[model samples]
Target: MATVILVRHGRTAANVQGVLAGRTAGVGLDAVGREQARRTAERLSVVPLSGVVSSPLERCRQTSRILVARQEHAPGTQVDAALTECDYGTWQGRSLGDLAAEPLWSVVQTQPSAAVFPGGESLRAMQARAVAAVRRHDAAFEAQHGPGAVWAAVSHGDVIKSVLADALGMHLDLFQRLGVGPASISVVRYGPHRPDVIATNTEFGDLAWLGALGPVADAPVGGGAGHGAPRADEPAARKLAP
Candidate 1:
């Protein structure tokens, strides 16, 4: 059971403009977006990634390239359409403030399972395909590289959130409760019993600990010792936000 790190693509021009650029062509990462990706890449550089899969969108491709470049031995970026952004259809290229006025917007926020973009796909369909693609790739990586292997999936915010919701066994309607920021990392390891949500929407942390982790059948009953043992002088562990 390899661990999959879900990485949302860096911010884009559309993001700054509050526009939905769903499935739109030629929308690349903005300057701030590039910097965000580079910072994330620097954080992940300490760990060796066996595979790096990304959405076909330009912004994601750019972010993936940065991530692979920083890795010591990251396999080249592989594109997967199933990980692409949800098609916003008539809502594409529209500003968020504007889209909020649409009748379907309420359903999208409250009950995504029944929300379908006009002339595009439904939120339920997006989650199904995205989850399937991630699981498929996880199984393949584990079989080829062994269970200790780690991989990455660079995708859109909603796509990643949907996958996270499914991993957490939450219904699609509650998916909106999850927040996936640009260049953030969320980890999920598929185990025999169930998927473990290791981290979610993390912007900063020491992920080097992951390199030493191996597959486990079940989570520790008491949250297990935090990663590795604490240092002798380290004060009693206190919950810290990352």
Candidate 2:
């Protein structure tokens, strides 16, 4: 089986300010975010990684750099637009507080499955794109390196969460229930069948404990449910399929 490590980008100014970044440019990691990346790098450096991939977004690219730098393996790192964050469209750069003032905000919080960002993407669309991106990564790595290869992907929170949900066969409307903290690491192993999650929302400090024992941690809790949470009784209205 090939191991895939998914990392959420470090915090950003927008994250701190609680603004929607969507697909807008100019959003980059804040200082705390940088530190988070560095810590993650320090933890993953010991893993025998074969490759590293990142979203074209600046924040994810920067996080990938740090991760690659910490490794002695000198793995290949590439950028892929498929891993980009969800497009907020008109919501880009808008504050949550401001958006909350609108009636649409309630719809997004309660029924995001049906709400679409004005002139932007739907939650369903974001999940589809993220699932495609993850499958591409899996296919490429398996073709080039075969089983036992370990690869890392650096991306945004929403993108990472969506991909994780897809791996677990969860639906997109449940996306809000999953959370990927800054620089958090989620792991999955791919074989002939569906991918299996090793962990989700794992902190950098947890990596050191895992590394001390071996390259990977014990099988994740909840059998790949995002962050160890139980699966929803009813799958979300929006599927994570492409």
Model 2 Cα lDDT, one tens digit per residue, 85-196: 8788888889988998988787776666687888888877877887787777877886788665778888888788878877887776676788899999998766565667
Model 1 misplaced regions, further than 4 Å: 230-242
lDDT of 1 by residue, 1-242 (tens): 89999999999989999999999999999999999999999999988899999999999999999999998776856899999999888999999999999999999999899999998999999999999999999999999989998899999999999999999999999999999999999999988988999999999989998887755656667666667644334456532313
Lowest-lDDT window of 10 residues in candidate 1? 232-241
Which residue runs of candidate 2 sit more than 4 Å off their true CA positions?
205-242
Residue 124, model 1: lDDT of 96
Question: What is the Cα-based TM-score of model 1?
Answer: 0.93
- Per-model tally of clashing residue pairs: 0, 0
